[model samples]
Target chain A: MRESDKDIIRSLKIFSDVDERLFETLVTAAYAQRFPAQVDLIHEGESADFLYIVLEGCVELFASSHGRETSMAIVSPVSTFVLAATVKDAPYLMSARTVDPSKLLLIPSQNVRDVFDQDPAFARAIVTELATCYRSVVKSMKNLKLRTAIERVGNYILRLHDKSGKADIVELPFGKRNLASILGMTPENLSRAFGALQSHGILMDGARIEIIDRAALETVSKPNPLIDDFRS
Target chain B: MRESDKDIIRSLKIFSDVDERLFETLVTAAYAQRFPAQVDLIHEGESADFLYIVLEGCVELFASSHGRETSMAIVSPVSTFVLAATVKDAPYLMSARTVDPSKLLLIPSQNVRDVFDQDPAFARAIVTELATCYRSVVKSMKNLKLRTAIERVGNYILRLHDKSGKADIVELPFGKRNLASILGMTPENLSRAFGALQSHGILMDGARIEIIDRAALETVSKPNPLIDDFRS
Candidate 1:
């Protein structure tokens, strides 16, 4: 195994406590590849043949119905995608594509299942990882079903601001178009939602966002830790 | 162990392959209780102490934001809620309440974790269970984000119809108000969505629904199996 690849695998919290022997088996079966920007890594409904770990660059996980695609999540470097589908050997529910030229490690689904069965530590880690992923999606559902588009935008900015350690101005990580879909809104609606937040003390200049009146925004946004806090 | 409790535990696909001794440990720690209709079993943000398994009746799992609550899911008999939270000892993301008088088995979180660590069979079962749950929520997110409210209503009805076998007429399992919240809409909007579906050949009388024109509803719904199929 490549030293760099081994390092990446070791870095993931899921593999942190696994036996070195089992980890060696995992690393032996895994192979890394690079993809250009906007390349579809996996399509919805395709048999989940492999679990892709983003080694570098971002991947957008989205689902489409009636030709309209809504972004579900953005998997960043050093994280895995479609783990549940891969574990169960089920068809992918969401399509994944790179936002920029990316390097990813692909491990066969069968290997994942086999390793999971052989190593109790690996299995335990998978339980924790899958549980976290499940709760995260549940949080997303609550965010979608409980809040309006503008509220979503407001809380999202607040979360970013919080993550940046109280930076008054925070830059959007991805493009507005993708963020709109991630927030479950149309591009036009996203524009209008940002306009609505302006009344709540936000000033958007290109990718940079300035929270002019945090107090006022909090009144409108009502960011709850259960819904807004990602780290938990 | 009660014969009934052991029977229920054995029936769950998650526990089907586990050793009988471990199943006895689970059953010993589990205690069943009955609740009146509209009882709140667990609230969001509370530390998850126990995992609740529904033996009978239904539970509505919902989240509240800024004083407005939206139902996230309806858990029926033989299923579990807040499993991820219980497994990780994390705060519940969604509050669970009985939609009707319900019977539930409560298993201490610590016991669950202990058994999980000691029994590889149990750990594997949890892996499969958690993976199934993660995929289920992903499917829900896709339903909420990728489809409109009316389309959600349409597909939901289609799903209920599908679950009921070839029956053209189906009765809603819960009240319309709760169903409205579950579908992420105001009661009025739900009514409007139902009215909109009337044009697509759906007839609703109280809780009973008849799909007069399956093809028309399917066309309007555009129910792709990737987004709408529940059994997969």
Candidate 2:
């Protein structure tokens, strides 16, 4: 790995507190690779051989069952995916694929477990990371269970609006199909939901969504921090 | 706390490996209380003051929005809940209630955090516990997204059947109303689904169900270990 890449990995929250020598050991055992867009990186039900950290571009974590597939999460740069599976020595619950040409660091799962056992800081960090992940999924469950598709889409748009610096227009991060899967809606349902949101004062022009009236939209979305806040 | 209660708490997976002194400290700061059925234990937006371990009976983790409530998980004896919220010092993302007259041990969130920081064993256990929780939620999300309501009910029956030692008779752990919420369906829909399952070789009588033909039921459920296996 390049010194620059080691520096980037070192800055990650999960690794930042590890002992320097152990961190060095981890990075030495790790390797980075680049993959083209739409390439399947891992498949569900496979043994988790490595813990993946995306250094650049985007990766989609998804799952399939009985001839059906759904998007589970979208991982962007500087974040790790599949840590739980790695730590537990369990099979990957979801498959991962690149949405854009991406670079990722693959740390052998055995090394991660070994380091985690030896390094208290790393163990604590893993605890925090996993707890955050658990809470996020719980929130997502609430979003899925408590809200209707239109409400989910409305709240999602409000989240984007806030993330884009309260800008009047916000771009969809990925394709509508992925967004539909993320929101637990069919593509046709998503389109219809977007149409329904127009009555609440938003305009969708392909991927670029214009928030004509933020207040009107919030009245409909009623985005709650317990469900919508990612940072917490 | 009673000595017996402490023994129960000590044997819990999250606390099993902690230093004896630390375990005593945690239990010293903890207290056990009994709640009647239908009592709310914690609200969704409330700060997580304590981590709870169910000792007897059952607790239902649930969430609500737009005046609609959904059951998240049903917690039984000798397992912890809200560990993610306690570890993160975040508000509870879901409300919890006793599904039956229940007893629970409550450890102050601060003490849990302090113990977690001081005891590497405890930290490691917490990591393992949280990772398990995260994976379970991911599985649930997949179950929700990839399957229809009837399929979910069918798979749920198969799970209960296996849990009952392959007995032809299996009892629903909770009432139809709560089961419906847990399955992400209305009670009416759950009834309809159960009615539909009768044609697939199962008979439902209130909370009691008889699996007349396991093979036929499995055919409809197509119970995939990737989605149905909780032990992993």
Candidate 3:
């Protein structure tokens, strides 16, 4: 059973591309845990005890403002979160709640960082993960600071396409209100942003959003690493 | 001459506590270059050519929208900016321009990284620096999305106090407009924000801003990372 679970972890990007020995060590250090929907796995400003990997269901990451929460990212199956705090041994800046019945692997922070100290390649892998996290946050900042609401949703559709293996007709990841917070706007504003984009040729059908005229949409919404459409 | 410069490099937090021999290797690898104010040293979306240490003067890191630019960080002498770009071997996300006549020591991208590979302690140093950068950006994001304009200015004054070594009379490193951008508001809004904070009992005379009421300010402005209070 342990060997089969090791095989499961072997498929994750952090472990998948690495040598068998490192994968073996990581799997040995990490153990699987589970959570139910709406469960607060890690409270904002709480102790940094464990780093989590979502093996099933979904999680919402958010920060609070004036008692209201703002969504940052929604993590689905096969992704890690809360690492910035875990690695640094600092209190989490954001709280995470399970958005669906979930299965996770919680690696004790000390056990995880011990791998960093014990293995150079593993250290390199963690560095890559942190760098990737840093880039994602930068992209988020660019999205929030550089683009207005309408362009953000338009390009968000493009990103959804890209994230869903660059396929057509991927379902929406989060509910509209959560997505609005992630996009740095209110839900009413997000609905208006979507309407404005639709009038400009981007179309939405229930959970599925489609770019009817990709070129015109790109022209209308200038994209960059923020929007992931540079020429726009 | 080398010894004096080593002393200078040793004064920087990023390099000050580094291994002496590794520091010498970096010193040997670096070339000192001077630039006039307003010259762009690094441009967004381009390969980062060199990792720089400003030996004199200041540089502004700013990002642009449809021609509107927002100042990101005002990097002063003896500090390193863009460490993430150099360490991660990625294109810079923002452009850097000289804000004052500057002498900067340029360490080739390859050299900074190669040094990282050769010395584990220096590699640890680099990781610490990257962590610091990530934390600062995270703090900036909190300031942007969570805090009110008046709260931001009040906290900015507290930050300035720390930046000036807890000194009461502190001259700012950047012009008000640039600082305003970094604080994530229009210059006029920044003026109003400062005015609001002053009305709330924070006192200012020229660049020498003072926190007359600490508890009131703390109630209004959030402080995470106690390191802000511990400059040394």
Candidate 4:
């Protein structure tokens, strides 16, 4: 890996408190690779071999059952995916694929466990990261169980709007089919949800959504912090 | 706490690796209490103050939004709940309530963090626990998003049957209403799902389910280990 790439990995919260020598050892043991768009990164039920860090582009973590598949989460740049599986030395619960041409750092799971055993700081960081990941999934499960498809879509838009500094126009990060799957809706239902939202405050032009009335959207979405706040 | 209770807590996988002196500090900081059935232990959005260990009976971990409620999980005896929230010093994402008269141990969250920082063994245990928890939720999300209500109900029954040593008769651990919510279905739909399953070689007597033909039940359920295997 490039020195610049090593610097970026070192700066991540999970590695920020690590001893410099150990951090170098970790980076030295890892390798970086780039993949084209829509390339499969890992498959569910396979033993987690490497802990993946997305350095560029996007990755979608998804799972399938009985021939039906659904998107679980989208991993953006400068973060890790499947760390839990890597930590537990367990099978990957979800499959991951690139949404666009992506670069990733692959650290051997054994190396990670070895470092974690030797470094108290890294172990603490792992606990924090895993806790955050666990809570995020709990929130997602609550959203799925407690909200309707339209409500889920509306709140998802609100989240994007907030992430974009409350912009008037926000672009969908991925395709509608993927979004529908992420929000636990069918493509047709997602289209109808967008149609239903038009009467509230938003105007959808293909993937670009114009938030004409933020208040109206919030009222309809009823975004709860427990469910929608990613940072908390 | 009784000596027997302390022994039980020490025997838990999360506590098994801790230094004996530090383990004593943890138990010394914790206190046990008994609560009546239907008691609410923690509320969503409240800062996590204690790491709760269920000593007796059952606790239901649930969440609500927009006046709609759903059951997320059921914690039975001799296990911890909300460890992630406690570790992160974050708000509880789900409310927990006692399903029956119960006994519990409440360890101050600060104590957990302090011990976690000082003890490498404890930290490693926390990682394993949190990783297992994170994977469990991911599996649940897959189940919810990828399967129909009928499929979920059937698969849930299969899991129960497996847990009961493949007994011909398996009883639901909790109420049907709780089961319905946990399975992400309305009571009406759950009833219909059970009704639909009769043709698949199962008979329901109140909460007691008799799997008259295990093969037929498995055929309809199509139980995937990725979704149904708790140990995995």
The number of the candidate with the highest DockQ is: 4
- Considering summed lDDT, which 10 consecutive residues are worst modelled in model 3 chain A? A223-232
DockQ of 2: 0.81
For residues B49-126, write the lDDT of model 2, one tens digit per residue. Answer: 999989999999999887888999899986789999998899999899999999999999999999888887888787
DockQ (Cα-based) for each candidate: 0.80, 0.81, 0.36, 0.86
lDDT, candidate 1, B139-161, per-residue tens = 88887777889999999999988
Q: After best superposition, candidate 3 residue A140: deviation in angstroms?
A: 1.2
Model 4, chain A: how large is the TM-score?
0.97
Q: How accurate is candidate 3 locally (lDDT)?
A: 0.73
Off by over 4 Å in 3: A16-26, A76-78, A164-168, A226-232, B10-25, B162-170, B204-206, B222-232
Residues A142-219 of candidate 3: C-alpha lDDT, one tens digit per residue: 777777788788788877766777665667876888888888889899888888888765677766787677677777
Using TM-score as the measure, name the better of candidate 1 and candidate 4. Answer: 4
Question: Docking category for candidate 4?
Answer: high
| Candidate 1 Cα outliers beyond 4 Å, as residue runs | none
lDDT of 2 by residue, A94-171 (tens): 999999899999999999998888888888787787787788789889999989899899999999988999998999
Q: Which segments of candidate 4 are over 4 A away from where they belong?
A: none
| A100: Cα error in model 2, Å | 1.3
> After superposition, which runs of candidate 2 have C-alpha atoms over 4 Å from their true positions?
none
- Tens digits of per-residue lDDT for model 1, A152-204: 99999999889899888999999999999899888899998888898888898
Complex DockQ, candidate 4: 0.86
The iRMS of model 4 comes to 0.9
* Residue range B95-211, candidate 3, lDDT tens digits: 899999998888877888777766655565666556656655665676677766777777777777666666756666667888788887788998777777776657766655676
